[model samples]
Target: MNAIDQNAIQTLFTEARTHNVWLDRDVSEQTLRELYHLMHFGPTSMNCQPLRVLFLKSQEAKERLKPALLPGNQEKTMQAPVVAVLGYDTEFYEHLPRMFSHNKEAKSLFEGKPDFINATAFRNSSIQGGYFILAARALGLSAGPMSGFNNAAVDEAFFPDGKVKSNFLCNLGYGDASALFPRQDRFAFDEVCDVL
Candidate 1:
């Protein structure tokens, strides 16, 4: 397979910023669907595909989410066009027959273990969240992903069924570049990586 172009790489990675200021633009339902279609393709352990998103687009919906946010995250999140509550389902194994069809026993591995279920769901959903941001950028939207909220409040407010758990919150919209803080330094490769 051919590698993607440099500009595409920049769009998805190098130049992407965590936006805190948004333009007064709307994120369409079609675009939100496309975002999910893109990010769901990211790999998960045993093809569990545990991530479930709740996108708050209406003022009423955002208001319901307001109490969960930490003070610092409240303003920017409410101002953004969309706020996605990224979560994972503990009963994700129930779908294994469809998602990992080749393995008839796939569901058995996680069905009865609470700790294991939590670990797998959390780990894989976090990976999907990374893909979520990249997918948003690939589609010309700015992303601001943060975890400063009260998870219990969010889960109770949104996923009251008690099966899904919140992982993080991400705001999506056209961003105000002028409001961005100066780019921060990243650790050099040798400072953080090691050869086997």
Candidate 2:
């Protein structure tokens, strides 16, 4: 394949700041599906694909989420076109026979171990969340991911059965650039990376 254009890369990464302000436009359901279709291809450990997203679009659902937010995150969570409740299924391993080994044998790896199940769920689901952000960007949407909410409360409100648990929240929409603060600085490569 030919190299990706520099401008496209810049648009998806460098110039793509974390959006805090959003416009009044609505995000269509089809668009959301398209975003998921693109993101689902990103690999995870053993193809566990543990992420479970709850898209809050209606006013009632958004209101239900309010009590779970920290004081600082309330406004952003309420104003965005959609607030995705990113979560992980603690019982994800139950499906491993289909998702991982493609045979009945894979269930043995995590059959009775709660600790192993939790570890795999959190690790793979976090990776899935990363893919979600990238997929949103690829679909011309902006994101503001935050962890300020009460995860327990969110889980109670959204996933009452306890099979799934919240990880982080992301606001999604067409960003209101006029409300953006000046972009912040970042650490240089030497400050964050090392050569082998």
Which candidate should be chosen as best, given TM-score against the real structure? 1
For model 2, the local distance difference test gives: 0.90
RMSD of each: 0.6, 1.3
Q: Which stretches of candidate 2 lie over 4 Å from their true place?
A: 102-104
Model 2, position 18, has a per-residue lDDT of: 89
Pairs in steric clash, model 2: none
My TM-score estimates for the predictions, one after another, are 0.99, 0.95
Per-residue accuracy of model 2 over 34-102 as CA lDDT, tens digit each: 988998999987788889999999989999999999998899879999999999998887778778875
Runs with alpha carbons beyond 4 Å of true place in candidate 1? none
Name the lDDT value of residue 195 in candidate 1: 97
In candidate 1 the C-alpha lDDT for residue 135 amounts to 96
Worst 10 residues of 1 by lDDT: 105-114
- Model 1: how far residue 7 lies from native, Å: 0.6
